[model samples]
Target: MKKIVSKKDIAHLDQRFRANFINSIEGFKALNLVGTIHSNGGTNLAPFNSIFHIGANPPLIGMVSRPDTVDRHTLENIRSTGQFTLNHVNETIYRKAHQSAARYDTNVSEFKAVGLNEQFINGFSAPFVQESKLKMGLELREIKTVELNGTYIIIGEIIHIEMATNKISEDGFVDIQQLGTITVAGLDAYYKTSLLERLPYAKPLM
Candidate 1:
């Protein structure tokens, strides 16, 4: 039997329960560890499931950051340095990536705390996860605030991408599943994905 949850039902649900329900209801999401560096050279890493594609021509990407009710080191660092990195969470490093979300002191680098190695490349201002199979360095373009929720929509332009050459197909498609990239449902549940099939672009019947 199908169950119905109205707006009023959601409003009255327990806070944590409502959060889980709404987050998971949207289905699987891309999981990436955002990496930034503090002015004092301390590194910060935080796992975000909200990274999304904004455009392709200029290679834009978007990510959402929670409200600043408390200290959000990742957001703060990005604002200060105008640069950050998105590191794909793969089977070998998902556990350490998840641990990056834990609240830690501003001076403590999540990479060190979680036993992940920090990697800098080609003079990029931010660090990348050495264990990640795919990594992207981005420069902040703009930050839009949602009035209703006080969350931030961070838009960035892709500046650099590092991955295995074999992961890209001749047609320009990336085989993320083959790279062992993982996904997430809701706040804490992680999942691995497998490609069922690939379909060609749709067109009208002749």
Candidate 2:
């Protein structure tokens, strides 16, 4: 039997329940740890599941920053330094990545708090997760506000990429599954993925 959750039912649902319900409905999400550093050199790391590909020509990426009603160190650091990193969360580091989401004092570096090592590449100001199998350094491009909900959409241009050469296929597809990258459902559930099959591009039948 199918269960129906009407509009009114959702409106009346408990806050935590509603959050879980809505978040899970979006299915699996890409999980990454965003790394940034404040002007004073205080580093910040936070896990985000909302990262998405914006375009390829410019190698753009986008992620959502929840409303700034409260202190958002990751967002603030990115804004201040105009640079950040996205580190893929894999099985070995997912637990530490998840812990990065906890709210800590502005002076605390989540990298140290969660026991993750920070790595810096030449000419990049932001830190990267040393344990991450795949990482990207990005420069902030734009921030758009969603007035309806007050969340901000942060967009960045990819400037540097670090990954294992074996993980890439001849055609440029990255085998994330082989890299052990994991995904998240709702706010807490973590999942590993498998590739079922690869199909050719679709075309109209003659």
Candidate 3:
């Protein structure tokens, strides 16, 4: 028989253990490094897997941020300057991207500490990961606070996009498999992705 964990049992589990278990249960998540720059010019890079699309007409994306329980440089910088960049985690820079998750000091620049190059685009206040094959710049649109868990959900409008020409298909799909993008399971395990299959649009009576 397979093991089962009840809510009561899980409630009694160790804090970190419960976090790891719940995080991994969601399966593979897209790994991305969010880049931000403070007004003082300190840069921050943090890897987050919670980025999700909210709409296409406006090209909006939403990302979950843990409540201001700690000094989160990414969130603070985004609030200060209202801009940030999202960079896909590739196989070659997975290690460096993960390093950004560490709690670096407020004035510290993770790009400098982790050995990743920071790139700035015209008219943008945030920096992008130079080594990332796919990157996008965003301007903060709104912030929603989840009262239940004290989590913050920040929504941004896509302002700029950068990618290699060969990585995109004629139909507008980015071939992530060919891009060597990496996904994450739990908090530490990193993985490369492959296409399982591309299915046609579903029909009511297909």
Candidate 4:
């Protein structure tokens, strides 16, 4: 049976409930996942659910950063080094990734604390996580700030990409779901993924 949503249902709820409801409807199961911002100077900060790929040709990738009431280590590291790696979390580092979201002092390196092995290119000092099922190394491309909210969106050009050899198909598609990629639930919950169906692109009528 389908349950109908009526305005009266929300009207009776408290302000917090209403706000959370709106957030839940919009952002629930938002392909949310965690990634490590591998910074130069051997500093790696784990952050949750901030990954997005912007384009294909230039292979642009992006992530967002809100104001750090504490200290924004990821933002600062990227600004200084001009490079960062996005390491998608899997079953292995799930718990560690959540712990990284805490307001830790900038001096602490979450990478070491979390037991993530590091891989780095010689020219770039920022290290990439070897354990991630998928990872990308990006060079800083563009950054835009939302003036009203003071949040920043950082876009980078992908210079290198790495994936677990087993996850790629002979046809060249990355079977992320088959590889058991993780996703975010709400602010802190993590969920395993399952496939629903595949849809083809629409064709134009002659």
Worst 10 residues of 2 by lDDT: 66-75
**Candidate that beats the other on lDDT, 1 or 2, i.e. the better one:** 2
| Residue lDDT tens for model 2, 1-206 | 99998999999999989999999999999999999999998888999989999999999999999865222788898998999999999999999988888878888899999999999999999999999999999999999998898899999999999985565777889888888899999999999988899988899999
| Residue-by-residue lDDT tens digits, candidate 1, 81-178 | 99999999998998898888888887889999999999998878899998998899999999999888889999999989988556567799998887
Report the C-alpha lDDT of model 4 over 28-95, residue by residue, as the tens digit: 24232223343434475666465676898888877787765322567777777787877777776778
Question: Candidate 4: where is the Cα deviation over 4 Å?
Answer: 1-23, 28-42, 69-71, 166-172, 204-206
In TM-score terms, candidate 1 sits at: 0.96
Superior by TM-score: candidate 3 or candidate 4? 3
Flag clash pairs in model 1.
none
How many Å off is the CA of 1 in candidate 4?
11
lDDT of 3 by residue, 1-206 (tens): 89998999999999999999999899988889999998988888999899898999799999989855322678888899999999999999999988888877787788998999999999998999999989999999998989999888999999899986555566778787677788999988998876799877788995
* lDDT of model number 4: 0.67
TM-score per prediction, in order, is 0.96, 0.96, 0.95, 0.78
lDDT of each: 0.90, 0.91, 0.88, 0.67
Top candidate when judged by lDDT against the true structure: 2
